[model samples]
Target: MSQLRTILICDDEEELAHELGEFFEGNGWKVDVCVTGMAAIEKLRKGLAPHVLITDLRISDFDGAQVVSVARELPPEMRPLMTIIITGHVMDTARAVDFMCDYLYVKPIDPDVLLANIGEFLAHRTFPAAGRS
Candidate 1:
């Protein structure tokens, strides 16, 4: 059997985080949820390398950009294959370009659309061979 895909989701809205986690779990992904950016960072630092990361742009104790930045700093093998940022706030074009994410979705995000995008990203990405970064 194929290995299960993993995902980390960080959002200050506890309900949203839980709901997203459940949705992704139901779709066959192993999901981890955090209510703060720092918590998500801690998970990464602890070696919980996930295939994908979905974080809110504005979260408690820091922003999604910082979380993505931390994930990017991980070694190639530990880094997430895809990083996505979701926010309800309207951001300036120049400002939005600063986030280190593969995709940015404005909330309230349609979970189905996000899932489709994730599927497309994973399907198109070329992963490293086993034991390679």
Candidate 2:
């Protein structure tokens, strides 16, 4: 098997974070879980660039928007290829667009859908847009 696809999942809820992390890891992806937006940003700044980032909108330290903002501020070569925000709070459609998040999933998310969405991201990365017309 090839090297695992790396992913970072940030959520203050320890159980949820670990659950999502384990699910991704079980599927052969390397997973890193952070309970705070600052921690997530610190990890990214320290050169832990994952292929994707899945973050909850509301956390103890800072909102997911901040995490997305920090991610975007990273040097282009260090940024994650895709970002997905999952939250139980009211959807902030504008923030999603402004932050350049590829997708936003509401809470009580369906694991199957999340998995399928992630698979699409990996495929998209593997096949660049140059392949398109």
Candidate 3:
């Protein structure tokens, strides 16, 4: 099996971050979990270019959407950074799904479901993942 290029998870919830990190790692992805938007940005700036970024909408820290925006502004050679917004609030769901995220999943995200959809999410792209977990 091939390894995942890279995967970033930015969530304020500690347990969720760990669960996500473990999930991606089990699938051979290089995973990094950040609890804050600034930390996420710092990781990216330090060359942690992940193939996928899973973040939440509401947090005590900076907005997750802003984090996505910052990451998206990177050079094209550095982008196509597939994003997934996981929010509990239905109202914020629309914005996340419509623009910021390629896939916006509500709370209680099913780990297996997400894994199964990974390929379809990148079906239209040709970029290989950068690192393995």
TM-scores for all candidates: the values are 0.90, 0.86, 0.85
TM match of model 1 to true structure: 0.90
Q: Candidate 1 local accuracy as lDDT? A: 0.87
Ranking by lDDT: 1, 2, 3
User: Model 1, which residues run further than 4 Å from truth?
Assistant: 92-97, 127-133
Off by over 4 Å in 2: 92-95, 126-133
Compared with the true structure, all predictions reach lDDT values of 0.87, 0.81, 0.76
Root mean square deviation (Cα) for candidate 2 = 5.0
Measured by TM-score, the strongest candidate is 1
Per-residue C-alpha lDDT of model 2 across residues 19-118, encoded as one tens digit per residue:
9999888888888899998999999888888878889888899988788888888877677788988888775555567556888888888877898888
Model 3 segments beyond 4 Å from truth? 1-3, 92-97, 128-133
Candidate 3 lDDT, 21-114, residue by residue in tens: 9988888877888888889888777667788888887766877787788778876555535887777777642755464677877788898998
Which pairs clash (backbone N, Cα, C closer than 3 Å) in model 3? 5-129, 5-130, 5-131, 28-133, 29-133, 30-133
Residue 89, candidate 2: Cα error in Å is 1.5
